[model samples]
Target: MANELTISGRIVSVLPLQTGTSKSGHSWQKQEYILDTGGQYPKKVCFSLFGDSITKFPLQVGQDVTVSIDIESREWNNKWYTEVRAWNVTYASQQPQLQAQPPVAQPVPPQPQPAPQPQATGELPF
Candidate 1:
């Protein structure tokens, strides 16, 4: 079975860290990003990026892109949580062409109206 999932969303935030003990108690770097999927409402997903992958998916806030992720579900504190681990991300600019958008109609300007002329001071000409 394939352990990969794909999702498209905007990058909301990115956090970089360097605090993990190795066998010799050495610190290692870590990076992650939060993606906001614009669905019926909206959904946010967090994923970890490591080493070269982090550089491959250089994220910026409000950037729209597609991510190829690995998903894992775990139970913690009597609640289930889902994590999206991104393996590859493709920038939107590299994607193929989509259909062209319809042209927008320009708004019509209001026509000028003639000023009303005042009637001669209550006089009936015979």
Candidate 2:
């Protein structure tokens, strides 16, 4: 059984569908796509949609999307061949916006003290 994996990113390229005949005279077709995950350190991965799956989800380059895939490895002539196949695709918009912050309370100014009024001096009032 193939292990399932999901990844989200923008579409880098949508390669044309490829068709070929197997050694046993069977025809096979597949469509490939490259995704670039925008982040601190960007990453690129190539995945394919096989057979009828290609028509189910029509994808365009430069669009953001989340893709569900299955990982499968096969031994061919003493070498290993790995394939990442997409089974589900969902559109994803750009990063979410940050919430707005509340306004800060301003500090109140200090009030000035009233000056003292000097009445008549200790001496008798003139």
Model 1 pairs in collision: none
Candidate 1 stretches greater than 4 Å from native: 24-27, 73-82, 94-126
TM-score of each: 0.58, 0.65
Per-structure clash totals for the candidates: 0, 0
Model number with the top TM-score:
2
Candidate 2: which stretches are off by over 4 Å?
1-4, 23-26, 93-126
Cα lDDT tens digits for candidate 1, 1-126: 775678888888887653576899765666788888998999988887766676677777767888988888999999998866788888877533345578899999999998766668965544
Highest lDDT among the candidates is held by which one? Answer: 2
Model 2 scores a C-alpha lDDT of 0.85
Q: 22-121, model 2: which lDDT tens digit per residue?
A: 9999999999999999899899999999888888977778778899988889999999999988999888756333354788999999999887655667
